[model samples]
Target: MLILGTGDVRQVLDGAETEVVAAVRRAYLLHDQGRTALPHSVFLRFPDDPRNRIIGLPGYLGEDEPVAGIKWIASFPGNTAAGLERASAAVILNSMATGRPEALLEGSVISSRRTAASAALAAAVLASSVPETGVSLIGCGVIGFEILAYLRAVLPDLATVTVFDLDRSRAEAFAARCEARWPGLKTEVAASAEDALAAHRLVTLATTAATPHLSTDACRPGTLVLHVSLRDLTPESILAAVNVVDDADHVCRESTSLHLAEQHSGNRDFIAASIGSVLGAEEPYRRAEDRVTVFSPFGLGTLDLALADLVRRRAEPLGLGTRVPDFLPGPASGADG
Candidate 1:
């Protein structure tokens, strides 16, 4: 088995934003063609602390280099209070030929990158006409930072970013980091979420809100919302937008904003199409000029498998990870003594 720590994974993916986006796009295409198996993510939540959860996402990708894996990730929002990351994860990839685990990887990086890549890809496909010069981010955490990075890679014209967070200090710090990372880019810390939402035509919601607290009233027409956090927008807001999700069945569960919209409207017809369908469409997807568009991805497990496979394949040639020859017991040599 191969063991890849966080540093190894990051080293493999650091300047590979475009490649990561392409991998995520392929995963979506495979899913659209029904070439992947993705089970619903299992959420384990503590009764004592409703804000925290551990999710198990298992999937199989049937691309040319077929692979299977499960990403076990935990989201403890309170971890930020201790100056730690709120989410941590690990991914185990299984060999398709032998059905044995082959690689263990640090997953939080993979998770965040895949997520950011998905959002960037969706923006390219769903909001092609939207301006690329400016964007608004409603969260200022690790995920938000990654989203900005991936977006900049895909949308090279991106120049200005407006960010808002519940914590003012965090937002300021995120702004500083952004400027330091990309010296030429401009970053602003919005005074409120509404200000951030209205600041640009491209908006990304990556907050940790457990319930709906925001609506689309603050947004400009033709705004493209990358709804990464899933729960930040209200049901009415979702229903009003041109909803495009990665997977309808997968996203419409879990009491996400889209799920709440389904509950409120008692139907899924509000959803215009899946991102996969848009990507695979013979004709380009067209939208009204004055309507809002929201891309709500459930964070597909297949994406993680695809990316983890990419990392493993890349790392193998460079000898970047630790190899454990005895990770799994070899077949019994004759009968046990």
Candidate 2:
């Protein structure tokens, strides 16, 4: 199989946020049209450490160039203490005709950037009504930084950003870098979630926290929350908001925001609409004066494929990634009798 490392992936997407946003938009559109197939991810827990869980996300991105792939990603919060990213992933792309492995690639950038780009797209679309605003980023990690960059591309009026993280050093470092990268915007570190929430109507939860960090009590009326981290908000918080998910079926099964709502309410009816439905124009946006709006996305394989496709296209011209001979042979010569 052709194995493309992390260096290759990064080279392709180094400064292509705008293209990434467009690709994510297309993925959402395809999802709304029922053109993609994504099964509920399978989580395998370690026998020794129940907390260390590895997940398999397998799916096909339909609607042209139907690339099939699966990503195996592991999440170990303890990895941070060992000087490694909490989440590490690898993707395997297969040939449709031959059913053979074609490409093995690093999935970290694919995971991180597509996620940030998807959130940025949602923020841009939702911000139509609330254009003049600031963004309160709850966690300033790798994903958080990329989200800010893509948000700048989409929402130019995003003139201010209030950041908060449990780690003061990380927050300060993020703020300083953002100030330099985004010279026009004001970036500051807030002391608490409450302080951050109070400063901006657009809130992004990008922390690695295993439990809920923000509450409905902190969210302002008419605010739009991007729940990037699965378990960053409580059920009460989700129930209070006009919930919109990337994929209703997928999010309900995986995202903690949806899980809590489903657990407490004993139903999924509380969900307002899937963001895909909105993208397809099946569910129209209604402006409610006092309703909180939230978009929770369980990272979709189609999105990963879309971004990967984009990266491959860019890398070809830039000579960024290694080119290898065909890993998979053609279709079977004849069918069995």
Candidate 3:
């Protein structure tokens, strides 16, 4: 078995946003083509602490170099108070022929990048006509940072960013980082989430809110919202917009905004299309010029597997990961039993 740590994964993915985005696009296309197996993610929560959870997303990506894998990720929102990241994860890829684990990889980076790439791809497909000069981010965490990076990679015209966070200091810090990363970029720390949402046509909601806290009252008619946090927007907000999701069955669960919307309306009709479908359509998806469009992704497991496979391929040739010779017993060793 080969083990790749965070640094190894970072090295492999550095300056590879474009490639990661392509891999993510392919994964979504394959999924839309019914060439993938993606079971719903399993969430484990503690009775004492409902806000924290560890999720297991298992999936199979069927293509020329088929691979199956599971990503085990833990989300402890309180970790941020201790100056630690809110999420950490690990992924294991299994061989198809032997059904044995082939690689173990640090998955936080893979998870974040794949998620960012998915959002970027959706932006490119859904908001093709929308002006990309500026964007607004409601949360200023690691996910928010990665989303900005991926968005810049795909939308080179993106020049300004407006940000908001419950923690004003964090928002300021995020703005500073953005300015430092892109020298000429303009970063504004908004006074409120509503202000941020109203600042740009393209908006991202990546907060850690446990339940709905936002409405679309402040957004303009043509706003395109990337609901990455899943639970930030109210059900009414979700129903009011042209809803696009990664998977209807997946997102309409786990008390996501769409799930609440379903429960309130008692139907899934609000969802107009999935990201995969939008990407696979014969005609480019045309956004309503007079309605807000919300793209809510459930964080597909196949995306993680796809990127992990890419990392493995890159790291192997460079002799990066630590290879364990006897991670599993050989067939000869089992014969003795």
Evaluate all candidate structures by whole-model CA lDDT and list the values in order.
0.93, 0.81, 0.94
Question: Which is the better candidate, 1 or 3, if ranked by lDDT?
Answer: 3
User: Could you arrange the candidates by lDDT from highest to lowest?
Assistant: 3, 1, 2
Q: Which whole-number lDDT from 0 to 100 does residue 23 have in model 2?
A: 90
Residue-level lDDT of model 3, residues 1-337, one tens digit each, is: 9999999999999899999999999999999999999998999999989889999999999999898999999999999999899999999999999899999999999999998998898888897475679999999999999999999999989999999999999999999999989989999999998999899989999988999999988998888999999999999999999999988999999999999999999999999998888888899887988999999999999999999999999999999999999999866745454
Model 1, residue pairs in steric clash: none
Which portions of model 1 show Cα errors greater than 4 Å? 128-130, 333-337
TM-score of each: 0.97, 0.91, 0.98
* Model 2 lDDT tens row, 61-171: 786678788888888877866878878898888788877777777888898999999898888766536574689999888889889888888887888999998888979
Off by over 4 Å in 2: 48-51, 282-287, 323-337
Tens digits of lDDT, candidate 1, 240-271: 99999999999999889999999999999999
* Best of the candidates, lDDT: 3
Error of 2 at 284 (Å): 7.2
Please list the Cα RMSD from the true structure of every candidate, rounded to 1 decimal place. 1.4, 2.8, 1.1
Deviation in Å, model 1, residue 176 alpha carbon: 0.6
